[model samples]
Target: MLKDENFIAQNDDLDQFNRKRPQFGGRFLNDESEIFQYNAWDDVEWNDEQKFLAQEKIQKNCSKLMPEEDSELLENRAEFFWDEFYATHKDGFFKDRNWLFTEFPELKRFSCSSSEEKCQNFQILEVGCGVGNTIFPILEAN
Candidate 1:
């Protein structure tokens, strides 16, 4: 993950939130239109209503994933459940997540920065990297 110290920030308005625009690469989003300016997570300014809605969603998703029978088993052994599930089902579940570059531009240092550039021996560990679908494209892109 990219560290916070690598970013440059700007806050023109005292009432508004501070923005940390990264200098590692070019513009994070490809769009030029003002309408699409607030597309990224950092660009978003969450109001109280949005925060309440997000909390509700968190409760909903957490409740859905909780196992009623083996409630005690999932206390800290959630990984065991996922391991068993993937072992049984295998790679049919996940396809490659090709949007790693778009979402996290720091990961696309070599190719996205310039066409002539190439990267090697870059260490990255993606948690919940099911069946290695996410990392394969990043490795291939390298």
Candidate 2:
């Protein structure tokens, strides 16, 4: 969302593509948000009892669907839960995940420079019922 404010006319390079729809292309960059990317790398100061209690809580929440008792039912239950969630929210949950480029370089490499190569260059494996917020922005940036 940055703009030239110094009254400078910059010739933005336009990338052209040929297709029924156009692809979104932009340079990945960061500004202002990352105040400090460095970490001190210190270990957590949790006691043995506290650590055990935290693990128990995580395990309880993770296995709330009775995964150990019935694996098939757990899978179906998770899918149904996500389906209901998306059915309730719809596109309200979908958003532009421009940060994906920073973590996953392959997404940019897979993105086609030309619209003619759209959907023909790579494979996108959609898991669960996500609203395509992560993939669509990288593929359809205008």
Candidate 3:
């Protein structure tokens, strides 16, 4: 019963609504659930294979700045250094690097405003942001 333009507009609205739906990825918490099922942090320990895969990813990503030997050392030392660094600086160590908006176009989809608007508002929260590395990169890219 709808006109062609109206059907197209309704489909577009439905698509937008589907895109905006929030997704939850964890198991439900309950007394009947197994310990591993309830506790994501405890259940998510990395095995040797996973660690090796991560090491491979690091090697590939940072091949320019890190030789294999130095990369291994850097990866090992990163956890300790990050913890210590954040302990001293806490929230003050990072400056908001919002200039990255020009570099990463994918982030534009997260903007609340229309695409025509030059300034798009976005809220990005980084869980386990680890000395703001991810946060800084995203902020810089935005």
Candidate 4:
């Protein structure tokens, strides 16, 4: 269970309801040309050297379980890249999240507490929790 801090307000102004009358009622659907733009491969910038280095790194780290020539390796590399990227920025990127409960008081209800009836027996299990992301948060809350 996640518990929010008590210092925050339950409701935020951005979440408040606005009762003002609408100025326009008719829906206007815009053409796809005006609403969206799609680019072909020609518009993309590809650095073969960078791509080669990234691919080599992935194959080296994962023991080349997937073939170096495999397209699937690209996707797998993307996943690994994001995982490592977030891991590198973990502390700096997540620092603000420490105040989430204070920013939104309503979330405080989600905070966890030891079960009074069986506090000693309480056990928590988390899946795919990397480098104490979930563990540290629970410890901080407690």
Backbone clashes, each candidate: 0, 3, 7, 5
Model 2, 1-142: lDDT tens digits are 2333211111111121222212323222243354354222123367999999999999999876654658776676988887888899886776654445444544544433344555445567868555655766455432
lDDT of 4 by residue, 17-129 (tens): 21221112222334446433322222234499989998999989888465656777777688887788888887676442343333433433343343343333245575653
The per-model lDDT (C-alpha) reads 0.54, 0.49, 0.54, 0.45
| Model 1, runs deviating above 4 Å | 1-44, 53-69, 74-84, 87-90, 105-120
Stretches > 4 Å off in candidate 3: 1-81, 109-142
Q: Weakest 10 consecutive residues, lDDT, candidate 4? A: 17-26
43 Cα displacement, candidate 4 (Å): 41
Compared with the true structure, model 4 gives a TM-score of 0.25
Shift in Å, residue 22, candidate 2:
28
Residue 124 in candidate 1, Cα distance off native in Å = 2.3
**Superposed Cα deviation of residue 130, candidate 1 (Å):** 3.1
Provide the RMSD of all predictions against the true structure, rounded to 1 decimal: 13.0, 11.5, 16.4, 14.1
lDDT of 1 by residue, 36-109 (tens): 66534344457999999999999998777656667887856999988998898787778664455555655644
Q: Comparing 1 and 2 by lDDT, which wins? A: 1
What is the per-residue lDDT of model 3 for residues 1-142, given as tens digits with 9 covering 90 to 100?
Answer: 4343444454455446445532234334455546565333223557999999999999898776657898798788999988898899888867664333333435434422333557656676667644456554444223
Preferred candidate (lDDT higher): 1 or 4: 1
Taking all chains together, the TM-score of candidate 1 against the true structure is 0.38
